[model samples]
Target: MANLPTLGQRFRRGWNAFLDKKAYENFNIIGGGYSGPNYRTILSTNTEQSIISPILNRAAVDISMIPLRHSRVDENNIYKGTIDSGLNNCLSLTANIDQTAYSFMVDVAMSLFDEGIIAVVPVDTSISILDSSSFEILSLRTGKIIQWYPRHVLVRLYNDNTGQREDLTLLKSSIAIVENPLYSVMNEPNSTLKRLVAKLNLLDAIDNQSGSGKLDLIMQVPYAIRSEQKRELAEKRLAALETQLKDSKYGVAYADAT
Candidate 1:
């Protein structure tokens, strides 16, 4: 007979499986409703963790305080002079018009920390989308991707002035995206911080639903459930109450009795 897998082998298999997982997918539902991916729940959870995880905020703030960079990190400066003037002007400002470069970088860091993904989208172009120089530039916006398509992506832009979210569909060629930064530490299903955020999300959900429950709802029936006839009446009343709750537009049930 073939021997069963040893304990070490079984442990290794389980660990590997855990490491391969992406997300626990806890964002789909919150407060008994579908929470679409504007990342509200995740952000709410991250905000709740500020006290416990102060370092996260501190690090984010420090990094965001740094000015935006025109060239790559530690990139050879030899090619800096060769860069286009229009591109240089464009680099002076962030792609996001709603935000200054400071806030743009901050939001980018915050979004990565909270949602694990972000995008820089080109919303307009000076001459053509392909033009690189000659004092030409398109506009750029920093935002998160809500949906992806074959040739285009649906992005949710942050509007600071109006404090309202705006979504745009932009071509794939002009978008720079970073997904799942520090995946193992920040985004993986079983990672410590990821698990912490998931747990925080669960707690935040519970907190939001704490007082918004059916506790205030009360059902009344005149008869007891002891006898067969009374049981039928009680069931009917309960069913009617359920139907009333379901049929109402705002979960309000109306009844009249003399």
Candidate 2:
């Protein structure tokens, strides 16, 4: 009889598949939040650390992709579970840094989760059709399940003739759902959260810097194209000048004199 694969083997297999899939999107942009009424006053009066004291103990900007785990309590109130049980279904943005900063981030994430500000499930990227108002996703790794009901869905399209355009739609019925306080800070004009998101996105764009100290070649495409155009224009002008000189009567005289 053939033996089944070990738990470690299964985990390794799942992790490899997840890496191959590039399933995680930028959480900083997609993650919802709202600032409380006292946020403005806090910013004005508190220090940087104090500002994030509600969420974080230290100010560190690191990016992390964490898988969500499911846990349950028994009648005795003892929690028992396996991380692998939910490995397949969803991942969260735990923290930006390594294990050194993991605990801090996890604390913040859990606090946020308890407050019902944001769900700990992975961001759903595959739902292209809006036929149903809500849907459930199961993780292939852990066989965990997460239900999603999008309130607003935004899609952007680029057209050469028309430039870039956005289509924003309200997906759900007009029912009041408590929004995450972080979203308010995100939407506020000239807010720290907005600045942080911009910075994080910029960092995300250049996340894969090579050992040769080179950024993505897509960034250099515009300059390369411009250079090629200039070279072609210079060549055309030189060709025209040569043609003019050859076509003139003075051309023969000049050639003979030379």
Candidate 3:
């Protein structure tokens, strides 16, 4: 089997391939939708620690795809899913970073299951489309399926004319959590419950880091596309975080943001 690659590595490879194929045009500047001359393949994996199989490595992915409609369908080739599915719909995708025996199937199922989600239009987040659904989440490039959640799905549609994915978050607001003070005290006094809380906090921290990294990537895409500025800023930020991770500074321990 092919070896696995980190998420960042996979992204780098995908973007590079996109550059080589001049796939930018496939992304319409005016028209909202993704056009395809063809498709491509790629792989991902965890590090070598589990090469012996004594350990298990689970790598989960989130996917998002732009949906196409009647006019969206290419004149040359056609898609097999819903004929009425519009170009604005997303196909969610996901999978373990490690290639498991059923990885592909599992990922596809998740995407298919999450095919439709109701949310405001991406173009105008303020305008609610009670009948419309969010784009099915899928692998950014491969269109693989991951897990699906309606609340989590944000409607992002491409403007056929502009080729830009529209954001509708402003049209509606993300749900806010109102934490109860007692909830925070449930695990107090250093008990197993506290330990669990600590673990959860750590997981949340990791997720936040991953999320910020993703945003950083998006912000730096212009530079990446040009292949001009070396990702020095990103690298520096990573180096700082690497030091913190080594020091076990992530998670919930250590007071005050370093």
Candidate 4:
């Protein structure tokens, strides 16, 4: 009989497959807000139009949009600082953007940056493509040249279809950049299996650690509430992980390995 793959091997396979399927060319958006709804719209639209579009040949574009929450200086400063602090550390700062919406644009951008999937940069209003073939972005703000060699580029308009004609110039001059084409995918919640596995993995990690260390780490989380509440939550999560680990169908392999 063929040997069954170990849990570690399965995890590695899953992780590698996820990365291979998720690879994307870099993208920079000219204008957009970073609100939760805005991020949802962008993600949904991109997934529908670019990632899964039949006409586009299922091309993946790694999108990085500048946040409208800060001014030019502030935006530049924030991005530069993030770059300096190292991408992995940016998760802590994302809570400052918005906790109520955990997966907002800023959070997604930070996650992408962490994965080295894309870069987030600030540009002034009078931005234009210098070379379509080479994918050069010229920032009138600082006369600096930003080069992006993505398979495609797209412009997201806030409102009004009248301005699309003028924006078409920006699209025509650029490689694959185009004004918003009205298209979308049917929104669906994540699969229960995926969500369960993610939660189980997270909780297991915490549970395996020493109690004091886990509590210290939980307390350091910016969005986490009071100490007692955090402790209770950790206990509950650990209990849940234990329960799932006991399940034969979902976690038997993992539990056996541990």
> Sorted by lDDT, highest first, which candidate order results?
1, 2, 3, 4
lDDT per residue as tens, model 1, 1-258: 999889998887755657755554453331233234232323535343553346656666787677544453335544343344444444556544445555555566766776777786555556655454332444555677899899878889754334456897866676688775574464334456556667888898888888565555566665456889887876777778779888888987755451
User: What TM-score should be assigned to candidate 1?
Assistant: 0.44
Q: Is candidate 1 or candidate 2 better by TM-score?
A: 1
Q: Could you tell me the TM-score of candidate 2?
A: 0.22
Give per-residue CA lDDT, model 2, range 70-127, as digits (tens).
Answer: 5666899786764443222333322112112244234334334233342222123234
Q: Against the hidden true structure, what lDDT does model 1 obtain?
A: 0.61
Measured against the true structure, the TM-scores of the candidates, in listed sequence, are 0.44, 0.22, 0.17, 0.18
Q: Between prediction 2 and prediction 4, which has the larger TM-score?
A: 2
Per-residue error at 36 for model 3, in Å? 25
Ranking by TM-score: 1, 2, 4, 3
Per-residue error (Å), model 3, residue 44: 25
Q: Quick one: best TM-score, which candidate?
A: 1
Q: Which digits, one per residue and each the tens of the lDDT, describe model 3 over residues 20-104?
A: 7664556453244335521212222322212312211122122212322333446666665454332223222222122221443
After superposition, candidate 2 runs with Cα above 4 Å error: 1-68, 86-258
Q: Give candidate 2's whole-model lDDT.
A: 0.37
In order, candidate lDDTs are 0.61, 0.37, 0.36, 0.34
